[model samples]
Target: MSENGAALLDEVEAFHRRFNVFPLEAAYVAVALWDAHAHLVDAFDSTPRIAFLSPEPGSGKSRALEVMETLVPNRMMAANATANAMFRAVSATETRPTILFDEVDAIFGPLAGGDEQLRAFINAGHRRGASTWRCVGDGSSQTPTEFPSFCAVAMAGLGSLPDTILTRSVIVRMRRRAPNEVIEPWRKRLNEPEGHALRDRLAKWAASVREQVDGAFPEMPEGVSDRPADVWEPLLAVADAAGGHWPARARVACVELVKAAKQSDKASIGIKLLTDLRLIFNGAERMPTAHILVSLNSLDDSPWADIGGKPLDARALAKRLGEYVTADNDPIKARNIKTGDGVVKGYYASDLHDAWTRYCPPLPESPLLPLPPLPRRSDPVDR
Candidate 1:
């Protein structure tokens, strides 16, 4: 590494010291931010995408994005942005700015009707790039202009984004600071020359490394999925170019964080709802709810079990169903299973296709059995 590179590492250490960020976490961020700055040198090329996420609010995601805004290039900060606006800014013909989004979880909430589409766009945008059109307004007619892909994306939000987006992003999992771990005032840097000097120096050093920041990602392990590869590839390239603790650090970060992402999507409860339960439903066609319990309880040993927490029990499973199919209009309902039956019982597959469309991904093959119609009772017949 060059003397300048060594100094850059030192400055990053100082930045962490000044800000009270954990040393290792700060290194990950510093390396990533530097990689991003370097990528900006050829902003026309692919840009890196990152997201700062947490399980709940007040985890310092926004503050971290703010610090990054001061350290990056061609920066744009949006607290709550529409999908169109986000795409336009990233792929603008005249100027493609690196994006920093705060409170982004609200914009992509599960209940928010627009979130799915926006998530899809973001997944594609951070990838090789998103292709969108801008209309040129003219007196006589309008012409459509195609904008290039996004540069880099940094977003802060509650919990993880869709797995697809997560796979493409360098995820920083922030936790709420303990009462004892207080950060210095980043806003007061105006009065602290050292803070300002450090930020400036880091930016300059990052700019110097711009030429070396290519988009070569290391091969992910077999267990690891390809979701975040596009976003993390550039940053890994930057780390390899730096060649020290950084390359190893980058890989470690990816492995650990990727595992976290996988775990985040795993269902916590034991009860199977939607298509997941539907599969078990098909496996034991027409069994009493009691027999179904034996099948689901056995799934603890299956790939679908043991999500974030331990495998959910039968009662927890019922609770999950209650949350989903609670409205009066819904046909499925969860009631206490008679202990005699040895399982919790409820109707199956009332809206299996709908749940699959909304929550689960598309299946690899056709369901094992065609969905059966709900059994209707026959009127009493002469004996």
Candidate 2:
């Protein structure tokens, strides 16, 4: 059974390689294991959502999910669906559905409307026995109903996900295929049937060892723990069961990819601001507000340049910095800087030191602490 598992996984990996180009080698392994995990997802206490996200279009994010659609059990690819419709779909089938959610940015983006229920639904769905409580029946006679939320989910989208979803997800930051890269074209008529055949074989292999997988707790590689541990456990278990080079390869991918995620983090705007200021400061004790504004607005790659459609001004920057406090328990605000022209408002290195040390300090070569994000734009920017 173990050897068979390895061979089948190899086939699945090959199938994916032929059609879609994943961002990294680990991404291929992760997605293959994710596909296999979907068949026996009931055995695990939680399901890690896999997100293929890229900054721009034509990055093969959708193609990756499309490949998985053929391989997972009861695969349902949805680009748009209401929370009510989704929870119902989850419970409607006898077999748990493997949701291949494409164009997820459309539903989860900042501009999206009436999606709080859906976000909550996806967040709650991470753990087993999780359910969404809803009212069924007419207004006065409404009965509380539980809709089961646990299911395997793979998402493809244009941008990063909110941290609520990120902590529970295996994020694959995809890149556009370089001109030198080329692969076989995928046609539904020919390729879908091949993928479906592989799915059937994977399902059989999974059924044979469901009990073993259910009881097994695969060991984590050094430095992988907490939510990262939870996310990779089942995939490691699948690798351990396969009894081949896969176990070693799986651990290698786990460590490198987890490390990659930490270095690539862009989740918090506040942290972004802190880190950017650190760069702009460059060992200076203080900078005039005018100089600071020029540096901030000059940053073409970061959001500070065009936050809310205008270059971040002194007042707005001050407001955001106010969210973090110094050791004295007061907002870190700018004080007078003695410039050659006149006295002008500016921030001191002494005042910002506390916020920098607490929020986005310089670090050693290890995993980064998960930084809390700042309040959203719903809070009045002017205030």
Candidate 3:
């Protein structure tokens, strides 16, 4: 590693120690940011953003953001801001703040009825240095104002975010606690001093290498689609500036994060059900209630059967699918479910289609540790 790179890594470690950050967690966070930087260099085809999520609440999303606020010299922004306020905050020349959006999903919601403006804002922010103008006040002839895009954005929420946002984010799916992995309650009174010391060191490091850290970037990686390439290019430059193991680490992080954001599973029964249903519709042209049930039941013999070791029945499938696609608290068609012989049962494909598009888009690349290929059995004679 170059002298500057080595020094930067040293400073990062020192900061981590000063703050009493758990080594593994700290390293992971560093790697995540480094990866974000790497993609900024070459994620031309990708969206340059990150989303942190946990299964349940109080899993440290806010705490993680607090630590990051200290490490990076960027300002925090609420994910719940109105479009105008958000734009103004990012555009302020006084501070080129890194935006942090906590509880983003809550702000957007499942249907995102009132979030169109926010959606547009986020889409624009995907373009580095992109700017837009919005009129202020309710005056008929009010003056308009222009705002620059976010420098960097980090969003945290429970479960998955909305599909549109998730499609463009480097997702960090926080794992629930493992049996052996326990975290003590963070007593701020006890740890504040140590965290503060680390914060000071990180600030110093930020000051010392601001120039190099701001400019250095690697060549874009292979297999990056057009959008990701654009979003991630500048981030990679940041990682390069930091140096040491960051350059390589940045690449790995880019690949992994992208895969998570746009991940797909051809093997999933959920995916198969949708695909199969689509095929059935294509071939049969159209079918009534009885045919739909028979066709769905027939899937058991095919590869698209069962989820989580249990066969997917129509009612359960409808309910699960409802979580993704349906907007109405009570679906219109679900009120009219009927069996193959015209018996009534609450399920419908219209709801399913809606769910499929929003909940499950295309998967990104397969995971690094892909499931092993099927094994071939040896012949008895050969044995």
lDDT of 1 by residue, 286-377 (tens): 33445555566566545334534455456655555555642334634454444564665554454344454555545668647888666556
Candidate 3 ranges with C-alpha deviation above 4 Å: 1-47, 77-79, 111-114, 184-217, 264-383
Candidate 3 local Cα displacement, residue 156, angstroms:
0.9
True lDDT of residue 375, candidate 2: 69
Q: How many clashes show up per model? A: 6, 0, 39
Candidate-wise lDDT, in order: 0.57, 0.86, 0.56
The number of the candidate with the highest TM-score is: 2
Q: If scored against the real structure, what TM-score would every candidate get?
A: 0.63, 0.82, 0.61
Displacement of the residue 253 alpha carbon in candidate 1, Å: 1.8
Error of 1 at 8 (Å): 0.9
Task: List, residue by residue over 26-46, the lDDT tens digit for candidate 2.
Answer: 989988989998998888888
Candidate 3: give its CA RMSD in angstroms. Answer: 9.2
Residue pairs clashing, model 1:
167-227, 167-228, 168-227, 168-228, 270-312, 271-317
**Between 2 and 3, whose TM-score is larger?**
2
